[model samples]
Target: MGGPAPPAGPGTAGLRAVRGKSIAVLGGGSLGLYLAGRLALAGHRVTVALRPGTPAPSGIVAEGDEQWSAAVEYADIGRLRGPYAQVIVAVKSHDLPPLLPALAALGDGATEYVFLQNGIPWWWRGIAGDGLPRARQVVGVVVQHSAERTAPGRIRVRRTAGDRYLCGRPDGSVDAALESLAADWRHAGIPAETTPALRRQVWTKLMGNATLNPLSAITGATVGELATEPATRAVLLAGMAEIARLAERDGAGVDNTPEQRVARSAEVGGVRTSMLQDRLAGRPLETEALLAAPIAIAEEYGEAVPVLRTLYGCLAFSSTSPERNPT
Candidate 1:
């Protein structure tokens, strides 16, 4: 209901104080590599924990309009022993399970866990339903940027448009650590802020993802392509309406109309959706988190999500078809 809190201290100098603190970044994906490079460049001691057998690169290289390179320490997930200032989980939602037990092994009360995945994360539901351990400090991060890994330990960040990041607790509580992390990210030129209403932010982003992602995967179309076509646009709006209803039922206030969301997507132009990329790459689609989870929530409330259900069925089938080969 309110805006983000102001930064606690002066500009880049205050953010620089975050340096020297140890951070363990889980997952060697695009976003993860980019964050590791940025934090390392900000002078923090960053260690990236990749899956076993992943080639250990000498350092991470970030490229786009401007280039940034930072030397980062590397470790296998099984080898991580952290009493770190923060442990950022940036893996795809579907790839999260195997890493969970390893993360829990880091000790219950030792480190702050920051999850940067898209859609509804598992921890979010735990916080809302069963509640996480009191000792663990969990922060939810919503990243709004276009980034892709060009190679091992190399990433290209295409856009840092707008307030590109949001971090907060699931229970709508203010957190000083989250605010400081946001400030550090901001100092690194990634627009970021700490909000009390993180779930609202999650729902807002989820509204667009629920509709566009699966539709793009099914049709192999770009966001602009889907937005400009009348039939696809209709399906998009219908799916968004269903999700908006579900959001209201779940107690998150999302105040944008379907048309407004479509307009916003149109402005993003030809960028391919992540689901489409995963589908083409023959990787496991994030159907559960982006589609199935929302559908389950809708069913729990006895709400109809005909469009969403149809999309989910199509994606689920495609994800399992023998014709598709894993890359």
Candidate 2:
């Protein structure tokens, strides 16, 4: 309703070009695929760089006249190079380091990165060790598309680019380029907005992710089933409160009450959080960045997060065998 809040501390990058631009998505996940489809459909030439381990379904590659099928490649950045205006890092946050050297190697001086992963931006700067040089060139994106690999390359994607998506600069101002990109992406889904207060967006998503993801995984339940009873919602609220506390102390706000977010979770019925899906499939969860990281930060800020600690323990204990916890 209002203009985005001003940049909090020393990090924020505005979009450079509001006119036509070529972009490459760095991963081949459902997010990348959906983005490719939407961008291409909107008349923007889009390329997705795929690594050997990245999953791709047998979905037909229908782009261009030749219609060459798309599959994963084990090529390095120099080999599978991108000379585009923007390079999007769609990989998991933990898996970011492997590609950073390549992106840094590009060193075009004009290429910007759009971070499509969840969690805090400050955490990202720490992980990559490049700080604001990398941070300022970043466009923080919030995505609400439910995705997973159905097979190798063929992802069974929903028609929406994503249900909720946004891109914002570090200082919280909208560049014409990001606004245009959002408009182009709308052909794929309903993108929420662009703002400078991306911290709020990221934290809102983290609250939902940190709470519901672990709960669902521990109990093997869907979102609706979890919220069906008051007890589960209470546990979730405790987790949310911990995040809210840390976010405020960290100098950011979700800018909404806990009750408002809790209600939104209820609306996404019959869906299991990503952690539940990962645990069931025996894949590693984003535990450090998603659950433990926020709780740990709460401690650093001289606050208590007992409920989060307990929930984190419960999730860690239940989602895996005792052997996994080094006990």
Candidate 3:
């Protein structure tokens, strides 16, 4: 799934009509609240879907160098009113199974589903086969922002680097709705663009997560700490090199070397990887999707990923052991 990249920049006249549509954002995580708040402030009728008993904030407050807040309606996942124009999924990969069936029940051929999650998405093949009506359009999103939940109903955007978001069709086809959605995001101060090389982009992001996330989780170190320590740095490079080879085998070759990735990590300094953050918060680690899945693919392609396998084992044990304090 690849093609020429789309033109860059904020808005075009054609996409001005994209606002004020009814959109449902699934999940109450920092990213989800940030997105729902931004979309609501952008004039879209935003509805946030949360699990039962999760507090439905009267409004979401986005804090960083500045502050932006917006009131958004909330709905329980099982009680969502149907036929949304677009459904933005911002849940963790591990939490997607139960939500998938509900999403399928609400979406139809014309409804557009946008997925924003770490690691590989389960619906990469196509949402049609996942019990959804064949008419639904699926767009994959690569979110590059660093956001954290500081408190209930509040989120902080810690860092904004490169493009804020990348949207593309999973099947590598162009859709006007996708382009318009990207434009809308751009107009709302979120740097977003449409790309045809969605799979390559996904693998490129995976290169960093597959290495840094688990390593940081295991060592309880920030990216900078991992980069500067000779021992951890060696493990980091070896794991990334394995992922690079796997990417090549999968025909999604990444150009950045492991050292280059480390250099980029250095720029982020004290920021901890998401897995490490989850560990500290006593939340479940996303090892299966972020680490094990890639290793499984590498094995299927007859490639060795010993470092990844080892990291996966360590993370699996750490997350489950009763004696360990993840923090």
Q: Which candidate gets the maximum TM-score versus the true structure?
A: 3
Give the number of colliding residue pairs in candidate 1: 0
Per-residue lDDT tens digits of candidate 1, residues 1-327? 224433322123434544566888988878899778777777788999977888899898877643767799999888888677778889899887766655655635646788887887787665432223232378788776667777789876665234367888877787666677776666655567777878777878887888899889888888888998999999999998888888888898675888888987888778778788777776677888998888888889999999989999987776787474323
lDDT by residue for model 3 (45-143), tens: 889997887877779987764376778999878788878878889888999886776776666666788888788778655555556535337778887
lDDT of each: 0.76, 0.62, 0.77
Q: In each prediction, how many residue pairs overlap at the backbone (N, C-alpha, C within less than 3 A)?
A: 0, 13, 2
Ranking by TM-score: 3, 1, 2
In candidate 2, residue 143 scores what lDDT? 78
lDDT of 2 by residue, 1-327 (tens): 222322111111231223545767776655666555444444455566666555444432432211223332333334555556677777766677566656754435566677787565443334346522355566778776555544444444332222567677766667776675555455423344676677777887887777888888777778877776699999888788888888887788775567766777677667667677667767677777787788778767888888778878887777567343311
Q: Where does model 3 exceed 4 Å of error?
A: 1-18, 125-130, 133-136
Q: Is candidate 2 or candidate 3 better by lDDT?
A: 3
Residue 172 error, candidate 3, Å: 1.3
What ranges in model 2 sit over 4 Å off? 1-21, 53-78, 122-133, 156-162, 187-192, 319-327
